[model samples]
Target: MSIQVGDRLPEVVLKRIHEGIESVDTRALFDGRKAVLFAVPGAFTPTCSEKHLPGFVEHFQQFRDKGIEVACMAVNDPFVMQAWAKSQHVPEGMMMLSDGNGDFTRALGLELDASAYGMGLRSKRFALYAEDGVVKQLHVEAPGEYKVSSAEYLLESL
Candidate 1:
C-alpha cells in the first residue's frame, strides 16, 4: 500500500543536486521540522513543467514563512533534475531530490510503471506533508489528474 498520514517515512538516501551531487537521508531532512515533499511522474512534462513546478516555485516563500521546508522529488537523475531547476529558475531554498534508482519511490509504495508513456518506473504524482519524520497529510492524485497535488492545495491543506 501507499504511504499514509501517520506513517513514518522510510529511511532512504535521496540524491540532491548542488555544486556536486549529494546523497541526503530522508530522515535528516524531515526530522525535527515540518516539510512539504511533492513528487512528479517526470521532469519537464507539460503539466509538471508549466503548472506543478511553477506553483511551488511561486509559493515557496509562503511555505518558508510557515516554517515548512519544500522540496520537489522526481525519478530522474541529479543532472536532469538540476537542469530542470535551472530552466524553471527554481530558487535555491527549494530542493530538487532525485530518486535515481526508484529506491525511495518503491519503499513508499508509490512507484508507477510508465513504460507505456515512454518513462520507465517513476513516482506517481503526489504531495506529502511531513513533520519530524512522520507524515501529517498525504495526497495521491488519480492517474493523469493534478487536482489534489498542486502547491495551492497543499497550502490549503497545511
Candidate 2:
C-alpha cells in the first residue's frame, strides 16, 4: 500500500555520491527533525533533470529557513546520481540519494515499472513531509503529471 500521512518512514540506508556516503537510517534522518523527501522516476530524465530536481534545488534555502531538510531520491546508482547532481549544480542544502537497487522504493510501495519507456523499475514522483519520522503530509503525482509534487505544492503544505 502507498505510504500515508502518519506512517513512520521505513528504515533504510541509501547511497549518495559524496565520498562520505550516507547510510541513512530513516528514523535517524527524520525522527527529531522536519524533512522533505521527494522521489523521481530516474536521474537525468528530461522532466526530472530539467524540472523536478531543479525545483528543489532552487527552493532549498526556503525549505531550510522553514526548518526542513530536503532530500531527493531516484532509482539510479550512486555514480549516476552524483554526476546528475553535479551537472545540475544541486546546492549544498539538498541531498541526492540513490535507491539503486530499488529496495527503498519497493518498501514505500512507490515503485513504477517503466520498461515500456525502457527505464526498468523506477520510483513514482512523490513528496512527503515528515516530522520525527512520522509523515505529516504526502503528495503523489499521477503518471506523467508534475503538479502535486512540485516544490510550490510541498512548500504550501509545509
Candidate 3:
C-alpha cells in the first residue's frame, strides 16, 4: 500500500547533486523535523515546471517560517534535477532530490510506469507533510490531476 498519515517513511538513500553527487538517507533527513516532501513525475515536465515546482519554490520561505523543511523529489537523475533546480531558481531552503533508480518512489508505492509517455518508472505527483519521520498529511493527485498537491493546498492543510 502507498504511504499514509502516521506512516513513517521507508528507508532509502536519495541523491542530491552538489559539487558532486551525494546520497542522503530519508530516515536521517526526516528525523526530528517537520518536512514537506513532494514528488513530481519528472523534472521539467509541463506541470512540474509551470506549477508544481514553482509552487514550492515560491512558498519555500513561508514553509520555513512555519518551521518546516521543504523538499522536492523526482525520478530523474541527480544531474537533471540539479539543472532543473538551477533553471527554476530553487531557494537554498528547498532541497532537490533525485530518486534515480526509483527506489524511494517504489518504496513509497508511488511509482508510475510512464512507458506509454516514454518516461519510464517515474513518480506520481504527490506531497506529504511529515513530522519527525511520521506522515501527518498526504496529498496524492489523481492521475493527470493537479489540484491536491500544490503548495497552496499543502499550506492550507498546514
lDDT of 2 by residue, 1-158 (tens): 97889898998878886666667666776789999999999888889988999899989999999989999999998889889998999998688888988998999989999999998999999999999889899998999999889998888877
Error in Å for residue 81 of model 1 = 0.5
TM-score of 1: 0.98
- Stretches off by above 4 angstroms in model 3 are none
* Model 2 CA lDDT for position 155: 89
Worst 10 residues of 1 by lDDT: 14-23
The best-first sequence of candidates by lDDT reads 1, 3, 2
Clash pairs (backbone) in predicted model 2 = none
| Every candidate's lDDT | 0.94, 0.89, 0.93
Which candidate do you rate higher for TM-score, 1 or 2?
1
Least lDDT summed over 10 consecutive residues: which range in candidate 2? Answer: 17-26
- Give the lDDT of residue 144 in candidate 3: 98
TM-score of each: 0.98, 0.95, 0.98
Task: Evaluate candidate 3 by giving its C-alpha RMSD to the native, one decimal.
Answer: 0.7
- Extract clashing residue pairs from model 3: none
Task: Name the lDDT of candidate 1.
Answer: 0.94
